[model samples]
Target: MDLLRDVLKGQSAKVFFSVFMALIFANPALASGLASGTSELTAFKDWVWTLTGIFVFLFIIVQAVRAMMDQITWLEFALSIVKVVVVGGCITVVTWAMGVFGVAP
Candidate 1:
């Protein structure tokens, strides 16, 4: 907690980022621990897919409400649609690639 407080209240952002970068780059034990947890990580990947679907559903609902309330411009709505489509397409590609790689989803 003290370390976090010191980092947050530090005079320079550079100091904080440097410390963060150092920890991530210099941490071999952390990487090894994660590597050993690959089987457990598969469970979290399933949760990630569920959360992604929920996020897309919620985003569409919010956009629909905002549109009905006349809160968003047509251009913004169009852009939002494009962004959602792109994300969906990416997910589809990843799913396809996983199938091709014979990864059990």
Candidate 2:
């Protein structure tokens, strides 16, 4: 359990750092003219999507760590399920909104 926890902690930290760097350093200009809506709104939506993906991926990793540690009880599993459902629903809603707004080409 200790070993699994240690590995997961290290890996999670690495993933978090990488995502943070990407968010901070990614080209702002790439978002410009890439979508059809106002540049500010398009950029905000893109950032939201990117951050959501990062968070979901991190949740999956943490759940795997829990499994590895034999710590996935019914409650834990249920919570994970809820997290996935909520994130997926949000993604769907945001995607539809973007389409309806003609934000993406």
Candidate 3:
């Protein structure tokens, strides 16, 4: 499970873990009645993304602080921001693909 561990250690892992934990602990009844009880899924998705957004905000703040402190170069700070944006875009694309395939919640 080293691969999984590595994945979970990345910057976007906060988002991934929030989504993962929500799904893992999802209400069985709500999850089972997908057609009639979509509220649960929608709320869970929102919650996960909300948490992810908060974590992303925190990451940017930390990066900004580090840059201000000269711990990392300005170029490195810009690249980190780009990396975060790229990762977020990738997630958006993946979710879009899942929806297109009628596999998303």
Candidate 4:
């Protein structure tokens, strides 16, 4: 009975210390840096660049797929070109918008 009591008390002390440390170390302000308009804008811009690269890579892969399809017609090639152009234009527009909005660090 005494050993069981000691084990339970040790577990209770660990729980209490963990909770106390969590409260002591917690930072509520940075929980969502976007909410505070902090450094997360830099993170957002990095993500935008990463996504832009991914889209361009995917676009090239799609163009390659289109080229490999033996029965692909001129209209299909034209549509692929149009798709790439539209995506490029959209990326440019977003970058411009971000610049105008002062999303930079």
lDDT of each: 0.79, 0.76, 0.83, 0.72
lDDT (Cα) of model 3? 0.83
Give the poorly placed runs of model 4, Cα more than 4 Å off: 1-36, 94-105
**Model 1 TM-score, all chains together:** 0.49
lDDT of 1 by residue, 44-83 (tens): 8889889988998898788878888899976787788799
TM-scores vs. true structure, each candidate: 0.49, 0.45, 0.62, 0.43
lDDT of 3 by residue, 30-80 (tens): 556656467766788899999999998999899999999999998998998
lDDT value for model 1? 0.79
Alpha-carbon RMSD of each model: 7.4, 14.6, 11.6, 9.9
Output the lDDT of residue 100, model 3: 98
Candidate 1: stretches off by over 4 Å: 1-39, 94-105
> Can you give the lDDT of residue 53 in candidate 4?
80
Judging by TM-score against the true structure, name the best candidate.
3
lDDT by residue (tens digit), candidate 4, 1-105: 854676587776766777677774585644545655466656787898899789877876776677678557657767877887897798789978989999842
Ranking by TM-score: 3, 1, 2, 4
Candidate 1 or 4, higher lDDT?
1
Q: List candidate 3 segments past 4 Å from native.
A: 1-32, 102-105
- The alpha-carbon lDDT assigned to residue 51 of candidate 1 equals 99
